[model samples]
Target: MAIQFIKKITFNHPQSLLSFRLKTTSSQYVASRFRDATFEKFMDHYKNLLKVISIQDLILANPKNNPPSVSVDFINRLSQKLHLNRGATAFLRKYPRIFEIYYDPTLSKPYCKLTPTAMQISIEEAAAIQNTHPLVIDRLTRLLSMSKSKTLPLRAIFKVWRELGLPDDFEDSVLAQNPHLFHILDAHEPNTHLIKLVGTTPGHENFTAAVENWRIMECCKDECSVDRTEMRYSFRHGFPPCMKLKKNLRAKVKEWQKLPYTGPYEEFTNMKKRSKTAVMEIEKRAVAIVHEFLSLTVEKTVEVEKISHFRTWFGIDLNVRDLFLDHPGMFYLSTKGKRHTVFLREAYERGCLVDPNPVYVVRRKLLDLVILGRRGLRSGDHKLSSSESEEDDDLLEMENDQGDIL
Candidate 1:
C-alpha cells in the first residue's frame, strides 16, 4: 500500500519528495508539506510487530491448555484474519524463538506454543502492567476528562486499550478498583456501554499535559530567558531533514507558536465566534488535545483512524489528517500500511521512545524476539538448513536496514 501511494506521486526533480497541499475547513493552505522517511519506517516496523503481538495474544488468550498450545490447523484456518502474508506453519516456523511447533501424538497433529523465552517475556509484561496500574488509571482518567461529557464509549476505549497500555481485564482490574473516579453505565443506545468520569478527582483536578511538562523542563535545562507566558503558548518543532521550510513559512510558524490559545485540559467551547482569529485559536486547541492524547500513549503514537474515533467526543471538528500535515514539526503522519499512524515528534528520538515506559520496555522485548528470529534460539536446540539459514540472514539484513532509520 505504501509503495502504491509513492508511485502515484509525480516528482518534478530528482530531489523532490512526497508532499501534500491540503486545504483545511477554514480555506487556509497548510504551510508545512513533506514526508519523513524515519517515521514511515518506524510505522512499517510496528505494522508487523503489532501483527505478531496479536497472534501471540490469541494463543495466550486460551489458558485452558496447560502450556497454552493451539493446533496448527486452527491458525491455518484463520491466517487471513490474522493478516499473515505467508502460511501459518511457515510464519510460526520463522520465529522459532517465540513459537515452537510439535507433534501432538494424542491428536495426531502439530500444535504451536510459545517458546520458553516468549513465555517468560509475557510473564514480565503482566508484572509491568500490574506495577503501572496507577499510571494507567491516571492516563485513562485524563483521556475521559478531555471529552465534552467527560465520557467515552466502552467499545471505543477497548479499541485503544493496547495503545494506552491498559490490561486485558481492564474493566475488572482497573475500573473496578477506581469506583470513585469512574463508572460504567449503559448508554442511551441499546447494548452500548459508556465509561464516564464521576467528577474531577482531587489530585487530578490540576492535571498537567505531558507536553507542557516537557516544554518547561527543556526551558529550565537551557536556562533560556523566554518568559513563562510565551513558553506556555509555544511548542517545540522538529521537522525531518528532508523538509526545507520556506523563509516566510518559518516566520509564520514562529508567530503561530507564540499565539496564546486554550490548553488541552482547559475549556474552549465558550468561544463560538466564526472570525478567522477565533477559528485559528480553536484549531490550535485541537492540535494541543491531539498532542496530549498521543503523549499519554505508551509509544507516543496511535493509528489516525483509532484517534479519529474520539473526534466528536473531544470536540475536534477539523479534519485530523489536515491538522497533522499542517504541523509537520510537532506530529508526523505515516501512511505505511492500510492505516495512517501519527507520531508525537518530541516523544521519540530516531526510532525509539525518549522516555521508555515499563509497558513499552516489555513490548520492545517481544519486538526484539520477532526481529531476532531463529538467531535467538539456542545453538544446539535447532539446526537450520543452508537455505533456511540464508533466509534468516536476509531477513536480519532487511531488519537491520530498517533499524538504521529507526
Candidate 2:
C-alpha cells in the first residue's frame, strides 16, 4: 500500500492521485505501527504489495521500511543458485545410491562408493555366473537390494543391474512382483555381514536370516536352497548382542565439535548436486584451507583416495571433492541445509589428485568403466552366435581406423 509499491506509474487521472495518496498514508502509518515482534502480522501487507512492485526494485528503493530478514525473493534466488527444482526432492528420495552416498564410513556424512572392482569382473562373466563367488555375491546382493525399494532410483537400479549383466530390467520386474523390497532395504543395515562376522541378537535374527539367504544366493547361486534355515542358524555369531549406536558418525561429529579447517569450509564433501556458484564457493574455501596447510610446510598429508560422489545437475556429472594420492588428508564438499561448501581435514584418508583437475579425470574414468564394460558384453554376446569371430573383425577394423587417427 506504500506509494513505493505503486512503482513509477504516471498518474493519468485526478482520481488516481487521490487513491495513491490515501494508500501511501495508510502504508506509512502501518509500517510505523509495525514492531519487531509482529513480523508475522505484517507479512500479508507486504505480500500484497509484492504483486505490483518488483522485489529488486523495492530493495533498491527501500520500500516497506521494515524488510523481513528472509523474503520470498531471497528464497527464489537460493533455489536458482542451489538448483533446487521440483524434481530434486523426488530424485533425492528415489535414488538408493543417493542414500548410499549418505552411508559414509563416517556414518553421519553422505557416503557413496564407486565399484571399480565390479567393472573389472564384467569383462569375464555375467553377474549371474559371478554370483558363485560368495564375496562377489554378497557385494552383488548389496547392490541389488538398493533397487528392490520402490523408493529407489530406477536409473541407479538399472545401471547397477546392467553392470552386473543380469537380464534387461530384471530389478524393475522383480520389484513389480514384490513391492515390499523398498521398506525392507530402507530398514536393513549396511554392515550386516561384518555384524554376522561378529554376532547377532534375538531382535536381529530376522536381519541375520535375510542377509544369510542373500549371501547364499550370490555365493552358491542357490536362492531356492532348502537348508537355508539351518545355515542361517549355523553362521549366527551367537548371543544376545547389542548394537552400540554411539560409535556411529553422528556421535563422532558431535564429539569432534567442529572439524579442523582454515575457515568457512567443511571436513567432507557429499552434496547431491553441485551448482557453478556453489562449486566455486567450495573451491575458494578449499583453496584458502590448502593455502593455510601448505604454509606450514613441515606438516604432511598422508595421501589416499579423497572420496566424492558424481553429482549430476542439468545432466552433466562432476566429482565435487579431492585429496592427495598418498595423504590421509582430504578436501571434501558437503551439502547441509541451504549451504554447500568444500571442506579440508588433515586426518581423513583419500588418494587425492593434487593436480586440481579431478572433476574431469574422475568422470571420464567412470564413463570409460561403464562404456567398456557395456561394449565387452555386447561383443561377447555377438561372438557366441556368430560364424565370423568378432576378435578378427575388431582387428581388421582397428587396422583400417588406425591409419586415419594417426
Candidate 3:
C-alpha cells in the first residue's frame, strides 16, 4: 500500500505537510485490510472491528487534542472496504472471544484466577452497584448457598438444581427482573462460538445456556471492588475492549436506572464493552446537536437519484470517479432549503462529511463558509483566518503558527 509517514507536529498549526484539513479521512486503510481475507474471515475480523470501533469512540480516543487525528468515517470505510460487513453480526457473534477477555467484578479482577466457589455479596450494596432488583434477594441467597464451595464445578451445582426439579425458567425470571444480573451471568458468553454447560449444578444447566456467548465484562477495577473480597469472583470473557462511545453511553444510561442493578461491576463494565458500534455513539450525538444547533432538517429524501455527477456551488460537474483526479480536494454538500448543492474540492480529492464540519470547527454548530483543511490549529485559542487569499488557495497547505509547514 502506498503510505506516508505523517508528522505529528501539526495540530497547533494549519499548514503542516500531512495536515490537510478536510471533512473526510482516506479510504486506503479499508482497501488493504480486505485484500486477501476470505469472505468468512473478512466478515468476522473486519465487521467486528468496525462494530468495536465506533465513530464516537474514534473521536473521543483521538480527539483534536491528540496527535493522531484519524477520522471516524475513514475507520468505518476501512472496515467496510475490507468487505467484512457482508455476513452481518451472526457469524462474528459466534466468535465472541475474538477480542480480549475480561473478568467479572463479582468474581476477582479479570486477570485473577476463576474459582468455582460462589460467595454471597451483601444484598444492600448489591442493589446500588450491581443494578440488582429488590425482589430477587431470596433467590440470590439460595444461589449463593449452592455456590459456597471454593471449587465446585458450575455444572454440578446446576445438575443438583435440575435434579431437584427447580425450573430453569425460575432463573430466567430472576434474570429478566434484573437485567444487570443477566449482563453479569451472560458476560462470558462472548468468548466462544458456543459455550458448553458443564459442572455439577442441576437446576442451572438451562440457566447457564441462556447466557452463552454474551459479551459483558468490565475493564476497570475500582468499579468492581467490594467492601468484602469474598463477594467477588475472578472474571473472564472474550470481548473486545469497550470503545469510547460505549463507555460514555454506559455512563449516561446506567445513571438512569430505576433500582440499583445488583450485578457485578464487571457486568456493567462489560456492557460498556460492546460491538464496534460503540464508536459512533458520540458522533451520532454530535450530529444531533448540530442539527438542533443549526435548526436543520432533512427537508426531503431524494430516492433513486443517480450520483452520476456533482460539483461545487460553482456549477462545475464531474463524475464521482474523477472527483479527486480533477479537483484534488474532497466531496462536500451544502444544504439550503430542499436542495443539496453537491461539490468537489480539496476535501473530495484527499478523501468525507460530518455535522460540525471537522473538530477544528469544534463548536457544536457550524455556520457560514467553513473550509476544513490539514492546516494545524494555532494556539488552543484560534481566530478564523480572515485571509481571503488563503480561502481561495486550495493547493497551499496550512502552516503552523510558526508559519512553516513543519
Candidate 4:
C-alpha cells in the first residue's frame, strides 16, 4: 500500500495557528488521553462530558433578555429528554455560573436561571447566530444535497438545526424565505415534511469532489502496483494505520473499497437482495455521507445519536459507531460530552478546529466569559460588572467592534 497522506484540500483559511495552538496543560492532557484510549473508553468519557453540556445548552436555549427561571421539575424533565443519568437539579445547584438556583417559596418550586455572566454569554450568542445565518443556509444546503434523495426529513433536520446554527423556526424564517433554493414536501404522515433542494448547488459539487477525491486516492494505490497480491492490502491504505494488526482486516477493507461509488442522489431500494458489491458501495457512501455532514457543521462535530435519527434518509444501515471505528483517519470520536459525538479529524489541530466558522469564533468568546463567570461565582463575587467581565474574556479587539459582532 502507498504510504501517502491525503493531500490536504483547503476548504477555508484555518484560524491563526498561534491563537488556536494548544498551550494549556489540561488541554494537552485531554488530547493525550484521547489518543491513547480505546473507542469504548472515549465514548464513555464523552457521555459524561455531555451531561455538563446539556445544562449549558438548557440555559442557552432560553429566550428573552431576562429569561424565565426554570423550575427543578423542568430540569428533571430535561434530564430525561437528554438521557442524562444524574439529577439535573443537583447539577444546576452545583454549577452556579451555569445555573443560579433560587426558590419561589410561595409556589413551592426551586427555580433556576442563568447567572449574570451566562446571560451575557447568551446575548452575545444571539448576535453570533444572526451573523452566521447566511453560512447556516449554505451548510444546510450542503446537507440536503448529500442525502440519497436530495432531501431530508424535517424532524431530522430540526434535531441538529440549532447545532448547525439555524434559527429555532428556520423552516419558516430561513427555508420559507428562500423559495428558489428550497421547498418542503409533505410525507405520508401528517406534520412530517422533507426539506428538498430545488436544484443542484455548490454543495452537490463539493460533496462529489470530496467523495471522489477519497476514491481517487484509494484507486491510486492500485494503479501503481504491478503485483496482484499487493492489491490485497490496498483497501487498508485509507484506514487508520492502527488497524494493521488485525489479520485479514486489510483484505476485507480492500474488497469493500473496490465497490462502486454511489452518489447521494441514487436510490438503494432493494438493499437486502442487492449483490455484495452493491451493498458494500452503499456502506462506503454512508461513510462519505457522514464525513460530508460533519464538514457542514459550524463546529465540524455532531452528536452520534443525532445522525442515527437520519439513518434511513441518509442510507446508512450500520450503526453510527461502526462507521467511526472503521474510518479513524477521517473521523475522531471525542468524549467531550454526555452523548457519543464524532468530529472530522482534518478539520482539527492541537484540539482546536482548524476551519472554524465565524459564529464559532464568537462562541469561543462566550465560552471564555462563561469560564470567567464561573470563577467569579465560585469566589462568591456576585457584583462583577459586564465591562470587567468583557476585559477578562481575553478576546482580541477588533477595529469595528459593532460591525464585527453583528
Question: What TM-score would each prediction reach against the true structure?
Answer: 0.85, 0.19, 0.15, 0.65
Q: After superposition, which runs of candidate 2 have C-alpha atoms over 4 Å from their true positions?
A: 1-124, 127-151, 162-167, 172-174, 183-320, 323-406
For residues 1-406, write the lDDT of model 3, one tens digit per residue.
1232344443336565335543343343222221111222212222333343232233335434322233323444555543434432332222222211234445443221111110011122223222323323333323332221212223333433311222344345443444433322222345322112223234433222101111122323457553322222211211112213357644443332111222210111212544444423322222222212111111111110122211121122223323312111122232222222322221121112222222212211111111232122222333344466445444453333124212
How many residue-pair clashes does candidate 3 contain?
84
What is the lDDT, from 0 to 100, of the residue 301 in candidate 1? 88
Per-residue error (Å), model 1, residue 211: 2.3
Model 2 C-alpha lDDT per residue in residues 343-372, reported as the tens digit of each score: 233322222222332222322233333223
TM-score head-to-head 3 vs 4, winner = 4
Distance from true position, residue 340, model 3, in Å?
A: 33
Which structure is stronger by TM-score: 2 or 3?
2
Deviating ranges (above 4 Å) for candidate 3: 1-183, 186-381, 397-406
Q: What ranges in model 1 sit over 4 Å off?
A: 1-33, 225-229, 376-406
Better of 1 and 2 by lDDT: 1
Task: Give the candidate number with the greatest lDDT.
Answer: 1
Q: Kindly give the number of clashing pairs for every candidate.
A: 1, 23, 84, 6
